[model samples]
Target: MRPLVELVGAGYAYEDGPAVLSGVDFGIAEGRALVLLGRNGSGKTTLMRLLSGGLRPGSGALRLDGEVVAHDRAGLTRLRTAVQLVVQDPDDQLFAASVEQDVSFGPMNLGLPVAEVRERVESALSALDITALRDRPTHLLSYGQRKRAAIAGAVAMAPRVLILDEPTAGLDPDGQERLLDVLAGLRSAGTTVVMATHDVELAVRWADDAAVLTPSGIRTGPAGSLLADPELLSSAGLRQAWAPAVTSFLRTHGFLTANAPGPRTPDSLTTWR
Candidate 1:
């Protein structure tokens, strides 16, 4: 099958501004997750906008399922519908009085049937486990609740590829866990996910492929390999997951003769002791 999305030599810049992205290239396959890693102002957001068809590239081309996406309104609309973007700030996305209304907004705007819209709204709320908040006012909810509502809104559109900007930002431990679980569920259901995050731990824990935007260029590889390389980690402004740090600490303290292989998840760290 063709990749869900591909960027070939894609570059973008604001009007008369310096180039935010240059010579960018990557491909996201169906049913796989790609995490965008970079420091602030490294063009991650610009790249996400390009992929979602929100912003056309100034140079080069972006393809959706093998078709060039440029100067075609219908194709762009279809691509936007298929590739939904969840903004970093939920407040900017949620305008409806209630969570259900907000979630249904996208499908309703697309002229979906009333029953289908309701079903999508309910299904999205269920997926995020926020069914209880469906009737609550969006503004009244906590930050985490609002974030989940924003995600539910995107889910209601039933996008094949979900692009999330800072999905784990400003959340407590519980909220982070909840959001991560939601993302994992989406990936398991074959929804390709591309999330832009500065959180190395989240990327290492959740993403299969990681791409880092740097002054030199975009670096792409498996998350594990990238995290294990200290130079790459520093260059990308990323740190190893908790388990790896603990393993290294144990080795330094002579608790282990050699640094053991790091555990994949935090829960698995308990077995190390």
Candidate 2:
């Protein structure tokens, strides 16, 4: 089956800078949570901009459902309807005074009817668990609340794919847990989520698939196996996730069987052993 979105032999470079990405092939499998991992300057954000229509690929093609994506006005409209990207900083995305108005902006701009727009706003607010803050001022919201508000704006678009750059960045542990729950709900509701993050633990715990950006190129595979590879992690300038370490220690000491599946979380130890 064709991926919902794909990049074929894609390459990108800034006006006068070296190519940040080259000969890349990426596919957004429908209904899967994918984590993009790399150190700073690995082009995760650049690649996301390409996926969301913010930046056109400098070479090769980006495709939606196998057809090459067009960047014209109508083309962009169609693309935006299918994909939405939330950046790292909430302050950069939030503008409307009230949370309701902020979350309503995207759907409203889509020219949805007031009732439909209201419904989407309510739904997104609920999905992010910020419905109570709907009437509150955006400026009055905490950093975590603002982040959810920004994500809620994207959620209100009802896109097929949502790409978030560091969704949990700047969030406290409780906030991260809450955001993870919100993400789980989104996936269960059938939205494909792609996130770029430095958190290997979160990748191991939450992602179904993962892509690691290295100087050589992008490596994509099952998060469980991919994150277990210490060499790959080191090459990508990422630390190995602790779950893999625990899995290794257990198996080496005969606490767990060698045939056991790679652990996804700390809780998996209990389940596996």
Candidate 3:
């Protein structure tokens, strides 16, 4: 399948600041989840902003669905509708008085009819399992509920690509699981998910592909391979998905096989004779 988005030789930096991203080349295939991993200030958010056309690259090209993005009113509008971004803080996105109103905001802005807007809002809330919160006040909702509401708003826009930044942040384990299930459902329905996160465990379990933003540049591959490489993980300011003990034990005993699949969880390596 053709890629939905591509960054070719992209470079970006804030005015008078050091380069956040340089010489980056990457692409996201339609209907696949690509996880972006890096430490704080490693350009993860900057890259997302660039892709969503909120910020232009200082150099090189960014293309969406095979067309290069230019910094103009028309192009930015097109980019916004084609690629929607959900920020780390749901509060920043959720400003409507009620959840239903919030979800309807996007479609409304698109000049959709009342009927269509209602339909989109309902469908998005149902998909995010936030239907019950439709009548609730946005400020009254819990953290997880607010996050889902923000996502519902984004989905109501029906963007071809969804960019999520630290989506699982500030959530409890149950909240994380709920968000994971929601994301999985989106992937099943053919929505491409590009998520930035520091949670290696979540990336290993959920993402099909992984890209690391290192001090050098962006490196990407199958999630399994990227998660298994200690050197790459370290360079990316991340840790292995499996515990150090398990990694060391496997290495010391020669049980780590070249052909073995990357370990998905801490307990996944346990094999009883």
Candidate 4:
């Protein structure tokens, strides 16, 4: 599949700060899940901001559908409609009086008809399973509820690509699982999902592909391949994801053949022959 977004030799740096991202070549394919895996300050957020048009790259190219992203007014407007970024913090994104109002904000900003905006808001709320909270005040929602509401806001925009920065940051285990289910539903419905995180387990189990941001630059590959490389993981400031550790243990005990496929999740270890 062709990439919905591509970064070719992209580089960026805050004023007077050393380059946070440099010489990066990457892509997020349409209708797929891509995990941006890296340690804190590994440029994951920077790359995400670049992708979402929040920050322009200081070097190289940022492209959407093979065309360079234009920085002019009309271009930027279209780009915003095409791609939406959900910040890591729910508090940063939600400010409207009520959940429905907050979720309606994006489509309304697009000058959509009131009926269409209402439809989008309802759909988004239903998609995130937060319809019951629609009339509630944003301030009263729990962290998980607020996160879902924030995501509903973005979903209402109906962007071709959804970029999430550290989506699992504050969720409990159940919250994380619910969020993952929503993301999986989005991917199945052909929404391209790109999420930034340091969680190797999430990357291994959820992403169709992934990219690792290292101090040196960015490395892109299949999620499993990247998770399996201990040296690369260490260099990138990541420990081996649990699936691989369990797979190794099973293999060493002669529980599986040398040519057996690796486990994608820790739970799959028991199924190895």
Which candidate number maximizes TM-score?
2
lDDT tens per residue, model 4, 127-238: 8999999999999999999999999999999988999998899899999999999988877777889988888888888887888877777778888877788888898899
> lDDT per model, in order?
0.85, 0.92, 0.86, 0.87
Kindly report the root-mean-square deviation of model 3 from the true structure over all alpha carbons: 2.0
Model 3 lDDT, full chain set: 0.86
lDDT of 3 at 119: 89
C-alpha lDDT (0 to 100) for residue 184 of candidate 1:
87
Pairs of colliding residues, candidate 4: none
**Model 1 misplacement above 4 A:** 244-260, 265-270
- Of candidate 2, the 10-residue stretch with the lowest lDDT total is 264-273
Instruction: Give residue 15's error in model 1 in angstroms.
Output: 1.9
Per-residue lDDT of model 2, residues 1-273, tens digit only: 688988899999999999988888998999999999999999999999999999999998999988888989888888899999999999999999899999999998888999999999989999999999988999999999999999999999999999999999999999999999999999999999999999999998899999999988899999988998999999999999998988788788888887876566766657753
lDDT for each residue of candidate 1 in 1-273, tens digit (9 for 90 to 100)? 577888889899999899998888877888878889887888888888888888888888989878897658788878877899999999999999999889999999889899999899888999999999989999899999999999999999999999999988999998899888999898877788888888887877777888888788888888777655666667766666665576667777887766357556678866755
Off by over 4 Å in 2: 252-257, 262-264, 267-272
Give each model a TM-score: 0.90, 0.95, 0.93, 0.95
Q: After TM-score superposition, what is the CA distance of residue 110 in candidate 2 from its true location, in Å? A: 1.2
Q: Model 4 — TM-score against the truth? A: 0.95
Greater-TM-score candidate between 3 and 4: 4
